[model samples]
Target: MKRSIAQLKEWFRRGKYPTESQFRDWLESYVHKDETVPVSQVEDLPRLLNGKFSTSRGESVEREAAALRLKFDRHKEDADDEFEKIENNRQALVAEDERQQGEIDAQQAQINTATGQLETVRKLLHSGASWTTVKAAFDVLGGNYSSLWALANTVKTFLEASDTSDATINRWQELESFLQGITDTDSLTGLLETMKQEIGTAYLNDLRKTADELSGIPATYAELVERRARGGMLPGTLYRITDYETMVANDPEARSAGHPFDVVVMALDEHTLSERAWAMHSARDAAGYFGKSKLEAWQVWYCLDNDDTRFQWADTTRGKGVIYRLIDEWGNDCPYDFKNVQFKRCNTTGDFVDNVVDDADWPNTHYILSPSMNGQADMTADETDYKWLYTFTYLEQMQDVRDASLINEVNADFESAYYNKACNCNEMQAYYIGEFIDDTTFATQALNNIVLSSYDEENGAAVKMYGNKWGAGCFNMTFHEHCYGNSFGVNCYCLIGFKLYYNTFGNDCDGNTFGNGCWYNTFGNSCGGNTFGNDFYRNTFGNSCVGNTFGNYFQYNTFGNSCNGNTFGNYFRYNTFGNECYNNTFGNGCNYNTFGNDCDGNTFGNYFWYNTFGNECYNNTFGNDCDSNTFGNSCGGNTFGNYLQYITAGEGVKYLNVTGGSDVKHFVQNAHILNGTSGKDSKNLLTVGLPEMSTVCRYVGQNTAGVLKIWVPADLV
Candidate 1:
């Protein structure tokens, strides 16, 4: 099987074939099993066949074998190389296929999310055609719609452009407007599709993107509100996004001024934009705490039913900034901002009524809080107030300051009010005379239920106009009952004061003192001689004259309001003159019986009690009834801001007589003492009414501070 070349090569390397003929026989034997049984070996054999052995060299046979071996090795190498190349190509193709598949998968995910969101938007839009509903749905989109619309408009503008002019851009815009004009819900889709066909896929894609964006943005608006809401957007205001190009195209002046012409705010909701008209209005911050609390935040303001329609806002134009105030009714601590607060007027309805809301014409809702209060008040903004606003319609404006250095001359304003003459005068007096429209009725209620100097509404503010000594002396008040609003006393007895520390004559915040020109705070007093305090106390079930809501401090005074003689447990401190006794000798606690009304000018020996404990000897003479005619916890407020207070040991604190100048060393404020009662740990109380801690001084000679150290004669005891 060896070729001639192979046989020749083999014969050249080998000295000789064992025999030329043998070589031929061997080559012939190997030819079938191996190729390249060389022609060289065959030629040698033919030489041997033609003539003698000398004709052919054995080298030919050796060359033939070597050639055969080389051919076999080259063939094996080629086959191995081809196999490796094929395997590498297969692996590369598999990798490329997998990568392409991953890209396709990502696109599939995008489509899924988009489909879900589009479905949600569709559901919201289908709910209603009302602005409220649409605005609610728009909140779900956050604000992405604005961006999308901007992008689409930009494209439309570019598309409308011609090579030389803006003709193409204008055409694209006109097509958009035409599409917007399709009002019939059933035909909207068809028209959009038609427009899509005209504007092409590029523009439609942009529009879809914009709508989708608007459907996904979060809501944001008004600042300065309480922050807490977390629902999707509450309500969305409609904003007209003006295209800058069109605005500039229409108004060259505005464009040149660099004034904003795009994105105008309007009062109408999204559903109202069939034509472009804008009206800016202010709104409460819906996203604030009120949004989160839902109903609780709405309970703070008082209401004025549509009863009194006398006055109106200073301005009557809508959409202008305005400020208004809510005032406490008449019986309210007049000038004292009695729960009244100022606010911006953001809403109103109906036509303006140039009438005044006075008590005579107050609406039915005009009412006053009951004197008996225990817990929180009711929460109903819809309730009709006993009163109404002077007027109910108007708008406001803001004054811009062009120069900071210019001094603005503004008059300082004070609130005031007058009440019915049937009431005794309150220490402080002021008035408010804005259109009573509704406050009049509320004012009447406030004055009606108040408790002043024994002046009951049934009896009047007072029958006689007492001179100087009348904390209840304001009987024939010159001011008309419904005349104005201010603090002339008689109403909410517990007058609130705005007195700053520097105010020597004004009712300030640093607590009122005697002779400082401030009035007393009677939570609610209607007349002189009025003695019942329904709101001052309370039991565990929340009922009493002066509820626990207030404290017990009768500091710097010697008597309370309304002494028609039915008062008890009331306290007194600095001021004097209402009791009947000028001098008392016998201890008064157990000595007095009935007082007040007809018992005045009574006298007794110095040994009798002048004011046992307000009714006996603590501060006055005598002339009050004895139901509980003594000062105690249920009578006054916690004492502070003054000296001398708390002078007893039984319930509130331990007290010492020290009447005979007998025991000054053992009767001071804040001194714990031993109880007279047996078997009880009697040293927990501290007395409060003297110059120092005399309780400690009582045991200066020994470590027995709280021990009972004073003993009086049997008669004195």
Candidate 2:
């Protein structure tokens, strides 16, 4: 009934096993009936069952099974040892990783602490700490001496680079001195306190003085009124009284004796008065300050209107007596007596007369009224009246009144009328005569409002005379001449001239002549002239020269504004706007160069050189030579020179003609012929005839003409 080992082996190969009930019954009945046997040993039961069914040659079934078990156990033991070793190694790696992470965290914490300390030290260094504090901290930290010195230098550099005041610099210098010494923190602190105290004390002292310095003088109205009323008179000081009422009240004896009060106030001291008080008092006392005799007739009326006590004497009197003594001396009637009469003064003689006086009666004097006295007349005079009747209404009108006797009489009359005898008699006479009258021939000549006149072979010629404004005249042999009102050529023959309103050659022309509004600036007997506008702005030599001529015999030279003249030349003739000709002749046998508005004339020869704009040229004759000239607006002249260059004129072929010897380049809008010739040979002529495009022509000598011309297209070449 038991299964053989061979049958069992067959069953195992064929994937067949015994039934659980059969196996259990067999184990209970034959192997062992003990339930204490471990079920883990059941795994070996199958191999034992296989061994029992096997046929071994030298061993039993039980021994074979046991040997197989021992081999399996050894393999299991080796795998377990390998797994244990792997687990131990994994645990050891995990501990090492944890330790490394702890070390990293501690290192990071130390670095953070160092960074915080460094930041703290930076703040202390930037805060302008004293040398004592820095040294103490350095010593405590055991810092290297070199590193501490470097840090101190760096801080010093930083502070110096910053915007430090003078006081801060001084404080830093003191700190440096202390650091050089063996000073402690306590000593440094004491020194700093002392410096602060001294600075504050000095600042307070400056502030007090500044307050006092800024304060100005303060005045009162009561003091001003008292000073004005007193007329600057001191107590018991004698003074004149012109007012009849005041004379009657203050000096009854003078009033009864038909005299004005000329006595002291007997109360206040004028010397003790304030400066402002004295000024106000002096202003009010017109008779004493301005002198009673020097007062004009109009001044008398003005004083009366202002309630001046000096003029009050006239108010108390009647008829002719009512007029102020100043008016009587001026040869003028009272304003109330002759309301219709126009009071006029002789500008040459200073004599007052009625407007009804004939012009011929005052031929020797300028019978004109000042602008201030013109208000006395009912109506203003016309030009004719200004010449004949009211001759000297303006200061310029007296320029040609050259009668010495008349001038003396006029001066005397003015002195008597205004009580103002001139301190310098010669100056007064010069003012009246206008020029030094050594010759008597100019005593009768008087030009009145004539625009142009020529006086030849006359001893004394008064070109602009008797209220001639805006007139021009010339004198040839006259010794004394006078011009007025933007006129030219006054006071010829060794007499000084006066010019006004941009007038050229207005006074004293020995051998020079200039036009109206032309500058008479000559050097070495040469005619260097300039024209100006309404504002009289001149063109300078080197800047914006319009029309100026230099050198001798410069004729018809027209420079635009302030053009410079020739330096050395005899005949710079017929130059129209030719400025700054250096030993050059312009025009036809005339040394002149015509430069356009704001152009310079640096021409060197007697040739007709006309430049429109800023053109610079050297010595060359014949056709219009515009070399290195920049044409801004239009170029309409014949240009020929060594290197005649033109730029931006017109877009066609008719405006500019640029003919030069060599290297003649033109970028103009339209050019007629760009002729670049080296010599007098047709073979060396480079002419570009491209009317539609701008061309650059050069002498290449490739062709028979020895020239190369490149034509660039209008759009692109």
Candidate 3:
């Protein structure tokens, strides 16, 4: 049986195209195999094609043929569209593959060139050529070299002139093998030029001079000893020494900060000559270099430890790391004399003592030595009778020593000492100087170490402890108005600065101008000017509340104390302890409105008008008999000029104009009003808060002209 039109169409729709034999089978299904058409009736095919068929089989043939033709055409169109899409996709993939392959090929080229250059440099270094010498050879080769042979031969010639070691000849043979293997001239040229540019050409002249006459001196230790024994050179004459290994390692551009041995040395006496020569040779073979290349020197030798004594007259040339420097002008009887002491462990210059940290009483650690301490200059002054007493106790105390590396080390050591009881109590007590207390480091250390001096009216020593966190009670203090209790920086006559204020529990009150109970409270430096806050703690009349009167109680029932010309009335309980109704007038407090520090330009009348609870409240005018009307914390420009009682305000509630009102429950808690007011005895009117994006306005009163009212969204109401 033949397949139907529906089946063929379904097959075509699912991307199954009919073959030639299948198409023939489908065409035969429309017409019977036995029903043969005569040659006379073949003329009627045109009539059938023109849709003028009479018989049902003829019409069936036409309908089925048309349906099959349409299906075939649709299949052809779909196949053509899919073929175009596949071809386009294939092209795009080919493009992307070509792009990635190009990058890979370029990267491989770079790798090959780098490998070749590395092989070249390896051979050069193996020949006992220092990086500086090899670099100089590449510099002489330059970019304008004509042939590969020229480049190779020039580098080899420079190497021969630089080093006479057999290792250089052997390594040069390896380098020659590598050069002969390089078939490509372009690759060789690129590698050599790159090496030259990277290594620089700064020391071309130095290399040339070395090549000419080899420093005009005996280049070897054996040669030097032979020449000296033959009396070719005198004892006091300076001679230049070379360490080949040091020169190879002398690349300061490397991470190790290389030590170059290019120093000028001379012998003192005939006995000491061999020793000095051996010292130089042994130092090179063992320790690499002395961290210095050259030094100008005038030496004076003396016998202390069998000819181990020399005083250097000249100074060091450079300024970092370990260096032998002139310590003092004195020559006390010691082999390791004060003249050429190595300032090694300090990571700074010898002037670190005089210039940076000039403290006569610096504490002892193992790293620093004191050679000028004991009475006797003899070795029998003590058991370990070296003049120097090395110490590492107090680098944190040196504020001028800003080397973060050394200071970080000191901080770690200090922390360990605190835990280990290495820094004892008396030593820590002596560390309570002005600079140490004022700096950034001791603040954190003060948690465990500091024991402040009890209230001294003479020097105000307890008050100057800036950034001291009161973990324990400050100086056995409990409510006695000490530095941590209530009053800080307070003497018998005047008030000094109460610097430290990180008090979680203690009341850090400062007695700057006043005698006893003047509180220079929290984070407020409240004792600078002469008249801080006088007549404090019950001596109320004529109290001079000026210049850093933080929080002092001046109580008298007559003429209130004036808070005038105060730099910072910081945390100043402004006549706040007692009912200072008559004699407490807050005068000119300055600009710093910190945590209720200074209530600048705030007018308060008699009988409880000037009671500020909120910190940093500015320009609030409260009328007389308006007792306890606190403009809440950070509330600015609020006018409560009437009979307003018990009005506890909110944060940042600005410009609340209440002309004449009494018994108002005006609890505006974060109600950010822009020039709004309350009616007489107005109760509990909440300004609706809204989402930040909502622009709608909801006001309590009518939108009157010139009376600017702030609003929130209506949906919030």
Backbone collision count in every prediction? Answer: 147, 41, 31
Instruction: Candidate 2: list runs displaced more than 4 Å.
Output: 1-480, 487-584, 587-614, 622-717
- Candidate 1 residue runs with Cα over 4 Å from true position: 1-385, 389-717
Residue 175 alpha-carbon offset, candidate 2, angstroms = 99
User: Over the full model, what C-alpha lDDT does candidate 3 score relative to the true structure?
Assistant: 0.35
Q: Write the per-residue lDDT of candidate 3 for residues 587-671, one digit (tens) a residue.
A: 3321111124334555543333334445545566554445444445555555655444444555555555644333334222222
| Candidate 1 lDDT over residue span 1-717, tens digit each | 354645656664657655677567556656546566665656567675678554356678778889998998999899899999999999998999999999999878755654556544444334324434544544554434443344335544554455644676577567556444334454434432333343344446667876844542222222201111222222343332322111111111111112112222222232221222221111332333112221211111111111122112221222111111212111222221112111111111111101111212312111212122111112112232211111110101111201101111122331221122211222234322234533453221111112111111232222221111112212111111111113333222322111101111111111111111122332223322122111112111100112111112222322222222222222322322243322221111212222222122222222121222323222222221111222322111112111112223222221222221123232233322223311111232222223443332221111245443432124353
> Model 3, residue 14: what's the lDDT?
66
Query: Candidate 2, residues 1-717: lDDT per residue as tens digits?
Result: 355555545545656677775565444443234445665556677676667444564468678889999999999999999999999999999999999999999879755655445544554434546645655554544433443344445554544566588987887887565355424443444443443444345446656665633331122323323544667534543222223111111111112112121111122365332211111122344444223332222222211121113322222332122222112232322221111111223232221122222222433223332222232213232223332211111122245422121121223233342222111111000011122234422322121211111111132221222222221232211111223323233333211122212233333333322212223332222222332111111222232331232333333444433344433233444444433433323432333234444333233323223333323332223232232232332222223333333332221112122343333243222232223222222233223322222354322112356444333334353
Q: In model 3, where is the ten-residue run with the lowest total lDDT?
A: 422-431
TM-score top scorer: 2
TM-scores for candidates 1 onward, in order? 0.20, 0.23, 0.21
Error of 3 at 78 (Å): 5.1
List lDDT for all candidates, in order. Answer: 0.27, 0.32, 0.35
The RMSD (Cα, Å) of candidate 1 is 25.0
